[model samples]
Structure formats: C-alpha cells, structure tokens
Target: MRMLINVPETVVADGLRGLAAAHPDLTVDVENRVIVRRDAPVAGQVALVSGGGSGHEPLHGGFVGPGMLSAACPGEVFTSPVPDQMARAAAAVDSGAGVLFIVKNYTGDVLNFDMAAELAEDEGVQVAKVLVNDDVAVTDSLYTAGRRGTGATLFVEKIAGAAAAEGQPLERVESIGRQVNENSRSFGVALSACTTPAKGSPTFELPDGELELGIGIHGEPGRERRPMMTSGEIADFAVNAIVEDMPPRNPVLALVNGMGATPLLELYGFNAEVQRALRERGVAVARTLVGNYVTSLDMAGASVTLCQADEELLRLWDAPVKTPALRWGM
Candidate 1:
C-alpha cells in the first residue's frame, strides 16, 4: 500500500521516460518505448534485440550498449510488448548483416516477437531468433511451455551481443545463443509478493514465516509453499534442483539473483550457500555473480542460475561488455 509516485496507467511509458532521462547516451523511442544504442544500425554487424515487461529493471533496456543489445522494447509491468513496437525496434536496428531477436520462453513474448520478425522480414530485413527456456522447475513438457526463462537471460544477452558486436554471422550468433540456453538452468524462491502499481497491493500474501518455491519472475505462484527456512536450507533446495537437472560435473557460470527487495547481504549469504552446495556435489564453479539481475518488481525472493561452461562459453564470458548494468574492459 505504500509506494512512491502516482500509479500511471501505462507503466511502460512512465518507466521509459525515467530510463531515457537516466541514460541520455541511449536513444529512446517514446512512441514505441524501445531503447536503442544512441548510434544504431551499426554497419555490417548483426543487431541484437531483446525485450520483455517493465518491472525487471536493468534487464532488456539496462543491457543496451556497445557490447550487448542494439535495441530493447519495453512492455507494461508483467506484460509483453506489442508486436508493432518490436517491429519498429527491429527495423530501426537492422543493418546489412541482419538482426537477431532474443526472446524469453513466455507465451506472449514468443507470440509478439514472432509477429515482429515476420513483419521485419516482410520489409526485406533478415532476422534470426533464439528462444531461452532455461528454468528447470517447470515440467509437463507436453502440456506446459516447458521451463520459464529466468536469470540466464543476462548471460545470453552479454555473450550473444558480444558475438554480434564481433561481426559473427546471424546464424552463428543465434546458434551460440541456443547453446547457452540449453546449458543453463534456474530456480527461484519467494518470501513476499510484489505490488503492481495499478493493483495497489501485493499480488499475493505470504505469511511472515512462509516461502514460495520454484517462483517465476512475474510474481507468479511457485510450485510449492512452506514455512520459511534458513538461507542454507533454501540454497540447498534451489541449487540441488538445478544441479540435479543438469550435468553435475560441468563447470558453471553461477548467478544468485535477488528478486528485488532482498538486500545484498542476504544475496551474498545465499551465494555462499550456493557455493557450498555446489562444492558438496563436486561441481566446478567457474565464475560467480550475485545481484538483483532479473526482478519481479519489489518482490522479496531470489533465484539461482547455473550455465554449464566450456572453453568457448568461457571465452565469450571473458569478452568485453559495456552496458548500463554490466560494464568491463573499457
């Protein structure tokens, strides 16, 4: 019930205004709410475009820069961007080398991005798409949409963007992106629900001592709910689920991501627990990251993602990246 700012009916527009003002170097299309590189359509290089809802800050938009996304469309909170917006972004970023759409495995996102790609192709722009479905918590492959794409998206954007920036062909970049998606897994737990500004209250109410397991990024109900436990116990359950689902012996690029409200101290503690769990299982932790990467508004929770790393993936991980959210190697 307590939040700042008037609830703008259109969350996407309000958020885009703030983001554009914050990063003048990134050009914003107010009509479409798409954030693109200040100088877009870089000649002779494949352009990378990704987008989703607005609440997950520093995601698609925060990732726009030299070595990441060329453009990102922003939707309303927990809502998919319309196809027209995506089509515009695609057209704006398209260069002679073609374009790539990095889509998360959500029903709306897939449908909208697919429509945009078709529209782009109709305009004679070459386009390739990669779908990321890396969450291990969901099952029923026949009926369900398989796993929900979660924290591994950050890795996908960074690595795939690097590939495009380095002038790799669209096919090669999309292929490598798929490889990254297949090798990654994520699981999340929620301690408290988030309030959508329009809704004016928390999406769900969790009693003081309960937690929801296997949560998705949109404050959706998780697989199970139970009394809250110690951070170590929570870490074991999450890390074990992911590790068991994937090959245990592979080196992993690990991420402990806070949903939003969780503090850095708690995230670090959870990361330590994750490291312990991985070590106990004899899994090699090649690199580690801890922060609020992908969030569900101000929800109190955390998700862990592990991407099996090889020499090629390691090389991509080491590639220089410059973005509002992640920057290294000037």
Candidate 2:
C-alpha cells in the first residue's frame, strides 16, 4: 500500500505531533497520547472526554476544544486506547463538576473506558459514561456486541458537550448524551476498503461494480455486498433504513458523512439526494451537515446519520463550539 509514513508504529504518534503543531488552542500529551484543550479543568464545568481508535481524523482528536470534548484519548489505528491513557486524561481535565466519558459501543473502548472511570472514581473524581450505539446498520459486529456507534457519536459529543459547558450537572450531561444516542441512527456504504499503515494493504477487498452496505468506521464488514447502483438509489437505501428506525416526521438534524476518500463534490450531490429522499418521506430536515467528519482511513464511501431533534436538542446543538473540525457560533 502506498502511504506517507516513516514507520507503521510511529504513524499515530507522528500524526498527534502534527495535530498539536497545527492547533495552538489544543495541547497534546505525546507520551500519553491524549489531546486536550489548552486551558482545561474549567471551573464549575463538567469535562467531556471521548475517544476510540485512530484513523478517523477530525473525530475524537480534532474535536478537542472549548465547546466539545475537553480531552480525547485516541488509540492506535483501529486499536482501542488503554485504560491508563484515559485515566490520565480524565485526571487532567476533571474540574470540580466531574468528568463524563462519551464512548462508542465498541467492546474494547467500552472496557477500557470503564476501567478508567473506576480508577478516576477511586481518586475521588466523580465519573459518568454515556455509551453511543446509534448505528442501525447491524445489531452485532466483530468489534461490538451490540449496535456499532457511527456518525451519531459526533451528535452526542456536540449536544452533550454544550450542556456540560453550560455547567449542567454530570448526570444531566450524561442524560443528554444518552438521549442523543437514542434519537440518532446511522447507515454507511463502502465503495472501497481502507488500508492501514501497519497492514500495508486494504482492510477488505471489494471488486469493481459492487458496494458494501452498512459498514463500520473500522472497515468492518457491513450487512451485505450488493451490486453498485445510482447515487439516488444508494441514498434511498440509507434514508429508508434511518426513517424506518426513527420515522422522522419531526424536525431532524441530518448528516451525510464521507468515509475518508470520497470527494466533497460527490458528497454534496449525495447530500442533495438524501435531503430529497427525506423530504419525499415527509421528514423535515431542520439542519444538515455534509463532510468527512468520521472516517475510515482512505475508504471510499459515505454514511447518512439522522438525529431527531426537539427544541432542547436544537438549542444545545446551536450552542457555541470552537474546535478544529467544527467551529461555529463562537
């Protein structure tokens, strides 16, 4: 596989170094592999910490800033970070209010964050966790026992982080996060597989004129492989899956996310079609975002995420946020 890296093992470390250099408002603990807002431990604010495997750029790491995650502990590419890393990050960011861990439903991530929470609680630091399992793509996967968390992971962080930044209690923040997860659903389709630097090969093989439906962020297999079809048809598949799960007759926040390699022009075209499909189904799209937010490394694909929104969710979502990837209303 063609990649720009000096060594496979150093890929994540090097990328973290680059991220730290690029964003002055963020600080990186290279040794511990933690990314945190430069001015952490905000007095009276509940700290939010969320992370998982690397390669999903602008996710856990790029999301560390004022109104989102206070700290993010990314593991190696497609590998879960250990408990020690999260424990240290929690200690560094926890204010008097406590810390909330917004974890995806992956098994490794769940277990490690659980240990970290216990460790922090032992030190008198209150800890709570909200697990995100919004992917309606599958009920079980190689990496998770239940539904895999996907695009809604971002929704939970943003909405819940806003509440925490507003100095909501830890329990309230956790509750909001859980609500976001409950209200959101996602489905992805992969046109091609991603190649990790270490593996130096595609994670999976997909021939021409075929697509994998309902894929995970780690290049894990989706529900099935099907013959390639028009963008409109693909958009319908995703929109239909989400609509059936949540029946979006109410206002909704929609996301059409590109898996690393999909171009923006294509994403916009797909986004338009997705919006059209939702409208056709009588679903109101109050807010729409299209971009490469959560990704698999070099995978050519896209995913659609829908989060049912009420006035409270809309308010929290509109709150100010200043992060490297998502910055608005600040």
Instruction: Tell me the tens digit of each residue's lDDT in model 2 across 1-330.
Output: 778898999999999999989999998988799999999989999999998999998899988888899999999999899998888889999987999998999999999999999999988889999999999899989899999988999999999999998999999999999999999999999999999998898988999899999999988999989999889999999998888888775899998999999999999999989989998999998899999999998999999999999999999999999999999988
Residue 51 of model 1, lDDT score: 93
Tell me model 2's lDDT, rounded to 2 decimals.
0.93
TM-scores for candidates 1 onward, in order: 0.97, 0.99
Q: Which pairs clash inside model 1?
A: none
Candidate 1's TM-score: 0.97
Question: For every candidate structure, what is the RMSD over all alpha carbons to the true structure, in angstroms?
Answer: 1.7, 0.7
**Residue range 53-101, candidate 1, lDDT tens digits:** 7889888899998888999998888888888888888888888788899
C-alpha lDDT score of every prediction, in listed order: 0.87, 0.93
